[model samples]
Target chain A: AQSVTQLDSQVPVFEEAPVELRCNYSSSVSVYLFWYVQYPNQGLQLLLKYLSGSTLVESINGFEAEFNKSQTSFHLRKPSVHISDTAEYFCAVTLYNQGGKLIFGQGTELSVKP
Target chain B: DVKVTQSSRYLVKRTGEKVFLECVQDMDHENMFWYRQDPGLGLRLIYFSYDVKMKEKGDIPEGYSVSREKKERFSLILESASTNQTSMYLCASSLTGTLNTEAFFGQGTRLTVV
Candidate 1:
């Protein structure tokens, strides 16, 4: 079994400011990490994922997340946020042997203010 | 691109009524999932199916049941709708195999139980 924990429940940042959303997971076996963004009244969209190879993964919209195995963390980051970036972000983990059943965190609401 | 479609965008139901939420995937993915999203809680998995006629309980499956009769369609059932079950429901599908697989989500169905 795998569990994901997103530390921040809300993150308020000004436009053009860099922000980081912390996430940690606990699992005895190998797992896959993912970040998803949900806009108001919509479902979630994949932002990035960390499976193998590089520990760092990036999205096309300037969002990135680093998978730290030692710390059991996969934190999402963005260099500069825009007003449109305001949304709820979720951190998830899937166990290797569970046939890809995802467990998500409580979510962090990112409010990018103008 | 993978597309997951939910049956409704918004639904209003009364308590004790039976409710069914439908989901269909166009990608022919082998795995389908049903999850509920709440305000404080990000997303909690209710049920999942890896193949037709195969279903598994997820983290929060007590109040929900699922059916996967065909390959492309999955349904989530609430035997007796309750006020607590009023939340956003999301359906997702993914390919089966590795832990790194990404799941595509639908636009979500907001169910309001009164």
Candidate 2:
């Protein structure tokens, strides 16, 4: 069985400040990593994903995450954030041959203050 | 673009009643999923269907049933609705054989059991 752990339940930051959301996973085999975001009263949208080569993956909305094989971590980061970036972020993992079953973390609530 | 649509956005049901949540995808996806979302718990997979007439139980399948008679449609059923089942139900779909592909999600259905 594979599982994801998001250390932060809520993070409060001011506008233009940098933010980091920590995520760790436990799996015996190689797994694919993903980050997803959900706005208020809406379904989730994919932020980024790490499949194979590049250790670092980025999203168009100034969000990026790096996959660390040694530490079993895939942390999401943003250099600068706006008020519009306030949402719930989730880290997910799926094994290579698991038939597309994505296991998600508890989630992190990013609250950006103006 | 893939479009996943849920039957209802908001539903109010009485306790001990039978509840059915419908999901439909238009992109001819090979995978469909049903998940429940809470404030702290990001998203927990309840059931998934890989192909027509093929369904699989996920992490949390207790008290829940699913039907996938068609390729584009998946239905989640609550045998006896309870207050604990009052949460946001999300439907998602993804392509088959893609390791890094992101799943497209519907708007979600907020079910309130009173």
Cα-based lDDT for every prediction: 0.92, 0.92
On residues B1-114, what C-alpha lDDT tens digit does candidate 2 reach at each position? Answer: 788999999999999999999999999988899999988887899999989999989889999999999999999999999999999999999887745567889999999999
* Position B31, candidate 1: lDDT: 93
**In model 2, which regions exceed 4 Å deviation?**
none
Tens-digit per-residue lDDT, A1-114, candidate 2:
788999999999999999999999999989999999999888889899999999999999999999999999999999999999999999999777444478999999999999
Chain B TM, cand. 1? 0.97
Best by lDDT: 2
TM-score of 1: 0.97
- What DockQ does predicted model 2 obtain? 0.61
Q: For model 1, name the residue pairs that clash.
A: none
